[model samples]
Target: MDFDYDLFVIGGGSGGVRAARLTAQDGHKVALAEESRMGGTCVIRGCVPKKLMVFASEYPEAIGYARDYGWDAKVGDFDWSAFSGHMRSELDRLEGIYETNAQKAGVKIYHGRATVEDAHTVKLGNGQTRTAKHILIAAGGHPVRPDMKGGDLGMVSDDVFNLEALPRKLLIVGGGYIGCEMAGIFNGLGVETSMMIRGAQILRGFDEEARGHIADCMGRRGVTIHTGCAPVEIEKRGDRIWVKGSSGHQDEFDDILWATGRKPNTQGLIAEGVGVKLDRRGAICVDDYSRTDVPSIHAIGDVTGRVELTPVAIREGIAFHETVFRGNKTPVDHELIPTAVFTQPEMGTVGLSEEAACEQEPTLVYATAFRPMQQAFAGGEERVLFKMLVSKETDRVLGVHIVGPGAGEMIQFVGVALKMGATKADFDRTCAVHPTMAEELVTMKEPVRVLD
Candidate 1:
């Protein structure tokens, strides 16, 4: 059957863009439709902008540390207007690059909302329909406000980058990475920040000890963290937002931000009409090869709810092209992916957490917590943690977790080692770099605990 194009991508996120570009580069006719900005969540709203904010917030702390090093240093008030203007400008540049790259690869770009009319047809917002031999869905997710009274009074993570002015006092809800990281960013920027979590601790499902250290450090750094409580109601009182907590405590803040969670963006795409299967969470159900129930349709990235990281999405797209176009079967490997949380103290972890490792095997934990030489000499109360989980029977490093400065950068290198099946002996034999926080990873000797 003749079609308008060989492939039609319904979203222009990292996953969709890569797939479209690669398929087009393979000499297939391809077109991509994006209703919003080309860069999607990571570049425009999620990781890129958020990390920039994190870097901006860290300057004040660095200035303070400078004073201890015998330099006369003082912190100036953060200028939100100036910083936000530059941030938006940078995002615009990145979005243009994404569009230009896709165009260079010979993929036609359509800037409008698109919905599936059938397994092989996509209808754009401007009253035009395009037919293709195959269709790909990679529309990402959006942060969702919790269902509660006066929920509209609160904002989500997306609204953070667009605030007219930084709040003098901010109340953040949830205990996940988004919530914790935002709390740190705002607190460092001189906002009186507070957070409420339903769970007993922040960063649930992570390395418990690492998260505990971060929570403690954040509290010491002036974030009013309330665990085992959530907002029951939010009310607007003049310019301030009043929140009633589950613990019966009430407070008022200049703004309330909800970092509760995100939902798959499968709503308006008409997946149901095309007989595509959706999971309970609204994510598209796909096979190992990213093919949906309809052979002509496929889904990847956050929309599929499988390892919703940006890099993972790109890998999935590569695998899809290999299987369908290059005639080589490829499946995305989701195991042992390293992740970092940009909290003030920071956290980088890979492989498995001690809690998760113990559930699977007899695990031995080697852990250390101490004031690093720099912080100790500078007379700061800050300390760093280095921990490794090893399989008792095999002497293989089951996990590596670090909480300190440069943890994110450290985990990226450690992730490679773990991926290569590096064991405890491999780490023990490697020489350590002197006068560094990361040296602790290879220096810890005895097992702190053994869980049978």
Candidate 2:
């Protein structure tokens, strides 16, 4: 059928942009609609800006290393307001880049929300119905605050980016990555930070070693972690917030951040008109190659909830082009995906946890622990832990986990190898680079791996 555009993308985030650009390159007209900025959550309010804060938070945490090495250095105090202002400027700069790239790729950018009017038609907020051969939903996700009264209890991850200033005392009300990250951030910046996770540990879905190392390190830095606790209410009490919780514990703080989690941003998409299937969390259900149940309609990124990370969205979008519009027709397998959590000490991991791997194969465990080379020079009592999970009989590495510096960077290649069924032998045969955190992955002796 002749259409206004070959593809109509209902998001301008990483996934939406990728789909629009690559599909456009495939000799098909593509138009993408975004209600706000060109960049989705990551470029706008998500990974990029958030990680910049994490990076800024790390400087203070790592500065102690210089002093520990007898470099008589006293890092000056951090100005929370200054960090906020700098981040705003950086985000502004990034917003423009996202806009220009889309234009250069010959993808029509619609600066308004899009609603699915039918299988091939999207009605933009500007009251125009654009029809296409295919429709892609990459609307992304939004932060959901905790159920509380006085809604002023706290702000979500999105609000943190727009902070007028950082609070000296932070009360993080969730145990997800955002909570773990911000808890580390404020505490590292010399603020008195407290974290309240309903479970025993923060970062529930991540590998245990990653959570363990972050929890231990954050504790060492004096961030009070309240586990097995859930906040019941949060209200301002003069200069502080009185937070009451399910555990009957009460705390007071100047700042409160509710990083409970995020929900799919589909409230006004009119998805029903196109018969798109969404799960209970509001995520569109997609098949192996990111196609929705309805053939002409597809979804990716946080909107799909298959993989919530930024890189995953980008990969899915790129793969959509390869698998659908392009001749390659490649499918995406989400297994062995490398990920990182930038908490106190930082962590990176790729593949299943030992427990999950063992569940698949009863006796698969590969665990290792040692101090990093930097720790040797930093003269600090810090030890980096590493773990791997592999099929005992097959010896095929199933997972690789790292907790230390450069974790996020090191795990990318590990993820590639693990995805290709790399065995412990492959890791062993690789020569180690001297004096690097990644060298530990190759040098560690594989003893009997233990399950979590």
Best by TM-score: 1
Q: Which regions of candidate 1 deviate over 4 angstroms?
A: none
TM-score of every model?
A: 0.98, 0.95
Model 2 over residues 1-452: C-alpha lDDT tens digits?
A: 78999889988888889888888877788899999887889988878987888888778656778788777787897887788888888888888888788888888998888899988899989788999988889999999875558556688888888877678788888888888888877777778999888998888977766677778888887889899988877778898888887888897888888888899998878655567888998888888889887888888899988889888898989988887787687687786678888776778888787667767875456666667777776766777777777677787888888888788888888888987789888888999998677776777665565543
Candidates in order: C-alpha RMSD to true structure? 1.0, 1.9
Candidate that would win on lDDT: 1
TM-score, candidate number 1 = 0.98
lDDT of each: 0.92, 0.82
Model 2: lDDT equals 0.82
Score residue 134 of candidate 1 by CA lDDT. Answer: 90
At residue 387, candidate 2 shows an lDDT of 79
Candidate 1's C-alpha lDDT?
0.92
Error of 2 at 147 (Å): 2.7
Model 2 lowest lDDT segment of ten: 443-452
